[model samples]
Target: MNTTYYMSYKLSLIASLAGLLYGFDSAVVSGAISHLSNYFSLDAAGTGWAVSSVVLGFMIGAFSGQFIAQSLGRKKALLATGALVFVAGIFTAIPYNFTMFIVFRIIGGIGVGLGSATAPVYIGEISAQKIRGKTLGFYQMMIALGILLVYLVNALVASWIPDSQWGTDYAWRYMLGAMAIPGCLFMGLALFLPESPRWLIDKNRDDEAKSVLTRINGAGYDCQTEITAIKKSFQAPAGAQAQSESLFSRKYRRVSLIVLTMALLANLCGINAVLYYGNVLFENMGIASARTAYYQQVIIGIAFFAAATWAVVNIEKYGRRRLLIIGSFICFVAITLLGALIWVGIASLWMLVLMVVYILFFGGTIGPILWIIIPELSPNRIRGKLMSWATFLIWTGSFIVSQTFPMLTDSVWLNHLFNGSFPFFLYGLFCLLWFLLNLFFVTETSNKSLEQISAEMSQA
Candidate 1:
């Protein structure tokens, strides 16, 4: 193929909106958590549950995500995710009671989970090898855009409403309700997207797969050869000691473990903790005004989007393994410094600087890689289900970290020695571990076809 990818780029960008919806849903709560807790009169644990209740939906969606995508086809599954987000966003904002709130939030979380599970794979499968990294990076960048959208929405809503009214009821509702925009947008975009060519080949729809592959790679593309490669990827590798039949089989076992671990650590490194609790973290870090903290989140959101843009532009320029290793190490250092700032009760400006630096490396490198690597590591024979496993781990880590953050930070005993820095130091430790794991285990997959990467993993 001579690399005509304009159509591929369009399809991939539209498919990437699932990520935007996911990001919006994930980050919208940050501006509202404290107010919602106050409104519901929740204890520390109750507040945690309030935030984590949605994560349960994420786990459920992740558990079932692959089946849904496999059965419905990637495009339809993405449409389903958008519908879930749209419906969940509406109910989440206007719940009759706390229980209702939790239920609806979980519903929305399901959409987020589905998006997390499907979009990257859809984008990757549709893009050519020359631009696959950038396409996947587009999904990651959309995630950042979603976060930035919500942050801006949250800030505007906060600034518009009176503080008393915001705390009493409106802030959380409005902030959450805003998610419907991206959800609706994703649905519209997904309706126009072509189903993944690899997916079509798996279903034995060779002509349809050929059509999509040609559209993606242009008229000159070797579509039949590509189709044959996809089909070959489904078979056990030549000369393997044992026939590998499933994701858990010897052929994929190591990669499966690697995917699951990376998924968990992706959130466990404290990104979600900071994102879901932005206002609270800033307050604890010494920002006195809620308004100021909300504005600060916008700044952080901007930094995140910038990093994501950097990722989209540079993921191919820098090899995946190098970016992951370097980013994780920088994240480790940034987080440690962040912890030190909190322990010593540093100024808001100093804390903000470190927070942006952490977000920069994380959002720029490791964050984007996760969206690609988990899918990239799986063979076509079991890619969807294998990715669901990793998505499950991602949600698991997200739930654990988001739920524990308030309790850990508020714990008198836990924070006695290090002040509010204990949990962060703990998170920083995971970042260091993340750095070492990528350094030692991950191999670069730049400029390779999906089938090529699949074969390499089987041989690993």
Candidate 2:
């Protein structure tokens, strides 16, 4: 096939809109949680549940994603997710009772988790080798774009109201409802885009896959050669069955271990803690007001955008493991600096810079790379199912972090442990540890195709 950028770019860009849905839904609730707590007359634990209910939904959705994706096909699975999100974004905004509110929010959570799990996998399968990393990074770019949109929307929603009115019953409703616009967009765009060629091939739709590759690579593209290469890649002794067996067998233990560990490490590097609870952290650090803190949250979103764009532009040039290694080291520096600033009582302005810098480092590398690598790491036979499992673990890790951060900061005396510096220190440790781990084990996957990667890993 002629490996041109035009077709791949369009598909990757469209698929990435799902990222916007994921990012918006994930962070939108943060701004609304406090206001909703008051409206519902809830205590800390109740509020905790309000915030975590979505994550619970994510876990449920992720656990079921393999079956859903396998049965529905990638395109249909994503479309189903988008439809759920469309309903969720609007329903979540209604002036219903707390029970109703939680239920709808859970619905939205399902959309977020399922889309987040499948979108990049779809992109990874269809993209040509030359631009795979950049295209894959587009998923993270869309995610950051979604985050930025919600942050701005959240700030705008809160900003319009008087301080006294900010916590009123209606404030949270508008914030939660704002996500509907993009959710609907994703649903509509998904309807128009082509399904993954890999998926079509999996279903023995070689003619369709040829059409897709031809479309992607232009009419002159050699559909037969492309199809043969794709087929041959799966022709090794292990073939599809061996790929499945090795995933759980001792034979592929190392591959299985690497995928799981990388997923955990991705979360542990502290991106969610920064993205999800950033506003709260800003306030805890004496950022002065909600407005200031919210704006700072927007800056974090901006940094994520800039970094993701860079990753998309350079991922192939830098390769996966190198980006992770470099990014992890940079994050170590950023977080360490942040911890030191808090411990030494650096200027408040400096503290915000530290946070922004940390996000910048992470956005360029860890955020995008996680999505880039996981799909490629799995064998073709179990790619969808195993990737679904990986997605579940990612959310499980996210849920743990989201639920614990507040308690850690409030109950465990994290501030006292390091004199208001413990969180950054803890994050720094994880980043540095990830850096060393990548140095030793994470394989370089820049120019290599999935078939090549599998061959090397199986031989090793």
Candidate 3:
């Protein structure tokens, strides 16, 4: 309602558009996969490569994103990421060959990696603790929205274009290139956002930090208190030597391990693999046609959007660890049942229902909470670096799942062993593992300030 609150919201909203681009780029390929495969005469492996290449680029970008953010500041880094997404989108749409398409997809993936690593960190840094979870949840919500929008676009484009044109090339090209619109918007808006005040303080720009903090905290709020806390968070404890510390340093090792484990598990549970190749997965599962699969993807996107919206509204109320554990458990059940249905040759419609249920739980739980918890758990001084590491691991797991799902599902040996449902079974197993990990290792951080979380991690 106040100037500070409005500005904070506006800035976070702009930054969160990066998530939209990430989602669009990630899911747009779903609609294009069959068309591209047909056009290029791709084998299963090549098809997998086309879908997973972005995640590989995402891994590299996330690995380097922290350094880029540290050197150029979050705003500049985000601007650069947006530009990359725009260029990658245009080139990807117009690529002359399969190799060129893969290259450009990787370029766009680099943008996704950069945006994924930085946007939530930027939102986390700028938001007040009271509303931080919801603010960061905005990033996840945008991601869901982007996925939903792309699915709709894919359906609409398929409908508008005749089968002759849609089958040849234009439909998929248009679908992939449409991302440039949002990419350009994100780049344009990044110019108006203030640098993370925490980043400003890290750079020893106290006056500038304070100016931004005042705008965030508003009149009648004590910006000085938050400023002092931010300073204190960066100060080394008594008798501790100040030096550049590795992310795996003794002080941070436990937290880093926890975050990395969570990140790895989140992706290993096969959420993105399902999302990126949803249409293909459904078709393989006996969906009537590619158009029907596309429609099913739209339904999945709607469920995802609904669940994400609910998570955004209630994350602060439920606490991160609780939601994660519950969500993982539900996903575990849904995935296992879905696999059983496939193995037993149940009605395809029931499998679709279970898929929706899996996404519902995923969107509400691990989908959004992973972003919130990683940043919340990190100490401010190294939050960016640690987040980058965690995100890199997340993408690594995603890359593995995305690249392997086709092979795993298509493998004759595994098919004989698992009744052709090996991938879902594996995902279910990871969901159970993720639930146990969260239950045992993760601590609740609801209502805690960043400084308090830092102090707790230091003590641990």
lDDT of 3 by residue, 1-460 (tens): 5554787778888998888988899999899888888888888899889999999999988988999998999998899889999999899889999999999899888988998999989999998888889888999899999999999999888787667645656888889989888889899999999999999988889989989987777767777787888988888767663532556777878888898899998989989867988988888778647677888899999999999999999999888988998999999999999889888877568888898999999998899889888999988767998999999999999999988988888898988888778888899999999999999999999899889998898664
List the candidates' TM-scores in order.
0.96, 0.93, 0.97
- Scored by TM-score, the top model is 3
Which 10 consecutive positions of candidate 1 have the poorest summed lDDT?
Answer: 236-245
Roughly what TM-score does model 3 have, to 2 decimal places? 0.97
Q: What tens digits encode model 2's per-residue C-alpha lDDT throughout 1-460?
A: 2346788988889988888888898888777876887788876567666777787777777767777777777788788778888888888899569899889878888887888778888898888877888888999999889889898998888788776555566788899888788888888899978878877877789989888888888888777976776676555454546544556665466777788777766777667778877777788777647667778888888989999989988888778888899889999998889889877776587888877878988999988888998888776656776777788888877777777666666654666667677767777888988898789978877787877776666554
Which regions of candidate 2 deviate over 4 angstroms?
A: 1-3, 235-243, 343-347, 412-415
Local error of candidate 1 at 82, Å? 0.4
Q: Write the per-residue lDDT of candidate 1 for residues 95-171, one digit (tens) a residue.
A: 99999999889988888888788888898788878888888898889989999999999898888876675565888
Residue 375 shift from truth in candidate 3, angstroms: 0.2
| lDDT of candidates 1 onward, in order | 0.86, 0.80, 0.88
Against the true structure, whose lDDT is highest?
3
TM-score of 1: 0.96
RMSD to true structure for each model, in Å: 2.0, 2.4, 1.5
**Poorest 10 consecutive residues by lDDT, candidate 3:** 237-246
Off by over 4 Å in 1: 1-3, 237-243
Ranking by TM-score: 3, 1, 2
